[model samples]
Target: MDENCDYIFKGYTPNFTLQEDDIRAIQALYGGKPSKSFSSPLSNSIETYQAVSKQMAPSVKSSNKNSALCLDPQFDAIITIDDDTYIFKGI
Candidate 1:
């Protein structure tokens, strides 16, 4: 992660339970401008973060595609949206 960066960039994708296109459709409905610090979400600038959910062992799969996972959480905050940008104000 960039230590100097105040905001992290990520795509709001499905939890792997739904089709990718469905997630994209939902995102489009909530469209807003990109933050000043980052490019629009539609840009290739969006990122994904992953972590090893299980310990590595002899029988366990160590390959990233098998062990890495990305979890999504719900957050509550005040959001300011304009035609081109959206900012989150959280406590």
Candidate 2:
């Protein structure tokens, strides 16, 4: 475990190290820009930050995927194009 990490995301960590897509995923994950300062010494440049920020836009994911401990709870509504209603139980 990296002690210097502000947020340790182990979800995408390869379990058996045999996932063929691991390399691509690792690249995408680490290549992402860090806006805020991390505990580590890695300097996150503004360009990297912007690129990663673009991929992590709130509009990318639906409201149902919001975690319970969501730091930002303002995303409570989403417009439906087909008028189909779907109830989302609290995650």
Candidate 3:
């Protein structure tokens, strides 16, 4: 057997938004605080944020295919919408 074959492969799908429990589980496994920085440029602009949210809102409400957590830099807030409920947190 090749030495590299000793490593186990794990597959993950991309572009999937993590839920609160998912985030907590990852943190518990990693044993660290989550990063404070936003990963997407969409977080820096309100118009873009609103636009994306508008696009994602229907899909999120209608199905489990897409979910989003967006940051509003101007207000220093993180927003997540699930079905009919919306959650906002300050960073």
Local distance difference test, each candidate: 0.44, 0.51, 0.53
Runs of candidate 1 with Cα error greater than 4 angstroms are: 1-16, 32-91
lDDT comparing candidate 3 with the true structure: 0.53
lDDT of 3 by residue, 1-91 (tens): 7843674333344786878887889988886664685466655586776767676564435333323334232332234556555444333
User: Which digits, one per residue and each the tens of the lDDT, describe model 1 over residues 1-91?
Assistant: 5644555544354663646776677778986445677655744422322123122224645767533222222233334556554533223
Evaluation by TM-score, superior candidate among 1 and 3: 3
Ten-residue region with minimum lDDT total, candidate 2: 68-77
Taking all chains together, each candidate's TM-score versus the true structure is 0.17, 0.18, 0.20
Give me the overall lDDT of model 1. Answer: 0.44
Q: In candidate 2, what are the lDDT values of residues 11-47, reduced to their tens digit?
A: 3345546355866787787875567866654345655
Which residue pairs overlap in candidate 2's backbone? none
Off by over 4 Å in 2: 1-18, 22-87
lDDT (C-alpha) at residue 73 in model 3: 24
